[model samples]
Target: MKWFFKIVVLSILLQSFQCTDTDDNSGAIISAQLETKKQEIQNYINSFSCSESVGCGFIAFGSKPCGGPRSYLLFSNSVDLTKLQAMVKTYNDMDELYNVQTNAVSDCMFVAPPTEVKCMNGICTIIK
Candidate 1:
């Protein structure tokens, strides 16, 4: 009876450790996916070029755990605006979901939007 009790307790402990490891692995996977999505959005933005400040624009990107966008991305009008917006929306949605799943915490500070976007030295950039 004593040996049986010990084996049962050990089994329960091992199962608990395995469950914890699985949770950690899943969280890491989600984080990696978020980074990949962010890179895709950035690569798409960088593929376009700008010649004039008037042609530069900014879009809100990423989701803060507390609420609102984490920051803005500057882009040129030369890119496909519709496609870019859709990609950004998808990224934002993923980020929001990740935050909720991970119980992510932040300072909750409001990130101010850029006052202006400009084409500076052939690159679209925020002027704030």
Candidate 2:
């Protein structure tokens, strides 16, 4: 999943570098299109999971926490354009449900939901 996205981005970046030798609007247009595609891919991914630790906070007492609620996703099988995906995430400290569509797929994809944050219960340390 992640590899596919990396390949796409890497290819775009490589193309950008390769374009410098030539003088034309082609490079700019290509980069812009590729970047837009990347953004679309990212938006589609966010519907599944958090790209990073988000809505971060912990359940603790007096600055010492025991546990915390983290963003999680239960993505369905591969996307079907004919259907919509039920996506959930924490918004304003509440669970927000969305029926968003899967727009695109990427080779270098990073599925969501990171582990416990670097800090646990107000204590900063390695999560591992």
Q: Each prediction's Cα lDDT score? A: 0.86, 0.33
Local accuracy of candidate 2 as per-residue lDDT tens digits, 1-128: 99999999999999887845455533232334434543554365435431234323222111001123232322222333223222111121121111111122234333334455443343323243
Across residues 17-44, which tens digit of lDDT does each residue of candidate 1 receive?
Answer: 7844334444342878889989998999
Candidate 2, superposed: residue stretches over 4 Å from native? 1-29, 50-128
Steric collisions counted per model: 0, 11
| TM-score attained by model 1 | 0.75
lDDT score, candidate 2: 0.33
TM-score of each: 0.75, 0.20
Candidate 1 scores a C-alpha RMSD against the true structure in Å of 5.0
The collision pairs in model 1 are none
